[model samples]
Target: MRAALYFTPSRDSDLTLAAAEWLGRDPFTGESVVSDVSGSDGLVDAPRRYGFHGTLKAPFALADGKSLEQLEQAAAEFAASRCRFTVPELALGRLGSFFALVPARPCDALNAFAGDVVRHFEPFRAPLSDKDLERRRKSRLSPRQDALLCEWGYPYVFEEFRFHMTLTGSVPAEQFDDVEELLKTSFAAFTGKPLPIDALAVFVETEPGAAFQVQSRHLLVSAETEE
Candidate 1:
């Protein structure tokens, strides 16, 4: 099994519900959702497989004798030690060949938090297999990214990471505008609003090429909550 640390809205939040309908699958319940957007199912096939989330720590195999239970416990404890914060706002924008919800501006807290997650869980990550390394290399990674991959098992960590909640797979150039318009309409309610970063979600993929599902969500503890 492969596990990923990700940040997703609360299961019943408006943003989560809207994203579920747009992506055609609810990561929380692992159920199919009916979408109003034309061709949405095909458009979101890629992100739908992984579920909608901002990647915190990329999926990794549990190292050696480590088990899922241990990872969950560690995540819970880590979350409890951290304070909640909010992204000032998010905007729908093009990220390479796809569209996603990205922060409107730089967020130092979010970056630091993501970096901490990557380093904190490094112990649980198994070294990348040759096949994994080959696949990552196909991206023609820069020297710095290749170095990060060798050390961290995922190239996009720390400074290389760009937080995004994917909305579609690669859209053809001709269809980009139409797809972007559709996504904008679908996500209008939540876009441009401060998004709470209060929890860490653990997602699990039972086997290779299978759809990932949420295993659990650990809420961040605040002063009031701790009290």
Candidate 2:
């Protein structure tokens, strides 16, 4: 099994429902949703398997001497030690050939938070398999990214990380504008608002090719009270 740290809204939140509907899968309920957007099922085919989430730590199997219980405990401790905050705004944007919701401006706090997660749980992460490494290298990464991949098992971490809730897979250049507009319309209710980074979720993929599902959510405790 592989585990990932992700950012997802509370199970009952309106944002969760809306994003689930848009993506055609609800990680919370493990139910399939019929999307209203034309050709949305095809567009979201890749991301749907992972559900609606922004990756904090990319998925990896547990390392030798690691157990699921230990991972959960570590995640809870990590969450409790952190402070909650919100991103000022989010907007629909295209990243290369994919569409996603991205922060409208840079957030130092968010970057630090994500970087911390990547580092904290790394000890429990198993080394990437040769096949996985090869697949990542196929993307034609820069020297720095290749080095990060060798160290972190993922290319995008630390300075290279860009927080995005992927909404589609690789899209044809010709279809980009139409897809972007469709997503904008579909997600109008949730975009351009303060997005809370109040919780961290642990997602698990039980086996290869299985859809990832939320195993637990850990709330970020307020720093003021801790002090």
lDDT, each prediction: 0.93, 0.90
In the range 154-181, model 1's lDDT, one tens digit per residue, is 9999999999999899998989888988
Candidate 2 lDDT, tens digit per residue, 1-227?
Answer: 99999999899998888888888899987889876768675778889899789999999999999988889899999999999989999888889899988999998888999999999999999999999999999999999999999999999999999999999999988888888888888889878988889899999999998999999999998767667
lDDT of 2 at 45: 80
Angstrom error at residue 128, model 1: 0.3
Task: Name model 1 segments beyond 4 Å from true.
Answer: none
Name the candidate that leads on TM-score.
Answer: 1
Cα RMSD (angstroms) for every candidate in the order listed: 1.0, 1.2
lDDT of 1 at 61: 99
After TM-score superposition, the amount by which residue 160's alpha carbon in candidate 1 deviates from its true location, in angstroms, is 0.6
What value does the lDDT take at residue 125 in candidate 2? 95
Which pairs, if any, clash in model 2? none
